[model samples]
Target: MKRLLAILFFLAGGLAAELAHPVQCTLITASGPQQKRRKAQ
Candidate 1:
């Protein structure tokens, strides 16, 4: 249970960090989604 809570806290921290800076996230998503969606076909 402690391990699970630690992982959750880690993910939450990373999410907060990302939300604090969105340009990199938008660029990654924009470049990744096209290739991923094409491959999913």
Candidate 2:
């Protein structure tokens, strides 16, 4: 019984950590002068 409880606790902690992190995304504009600089370099 004690071993089973310990296993459950370990699994729960792992799942909690996994759910804590969230995804992220960022966007950049591709307007005229910015596009020109990229091509020039």
Question: Best candidate per TM-score, number?
Answer: 1
- Alpha-carbon TM-score of each model against the true structure: 0.53, 0.50
C-alpha lDDT (0 to 100) for residue 28 of candidate 2: 54
Highest lDDT model number: 1
The 10 consecutive residues of candidate 1 with the worst lDDT sum are: 27-36
lDDT digits (tens) for residues 1-41 of candidate 1: 99999999999998998899854655444444444345554
Worst-scoring 10-residue span by lDDT in model 2: 21-30
lDDT of all predictions: 0.76, 0.71
lDDT tens per residue, model 2, 1-41: 99999999999997776688533223555457544345555
Q: Which stretches of candidate 1 lie over 4 Å from their true place?
A: 25-41
Measured on C-alpha atoms, candidate 1 has an lDDT of: 0.76
CA displacement after TM-score superposition, residue 22 of candidate 1 (Å):
1.4
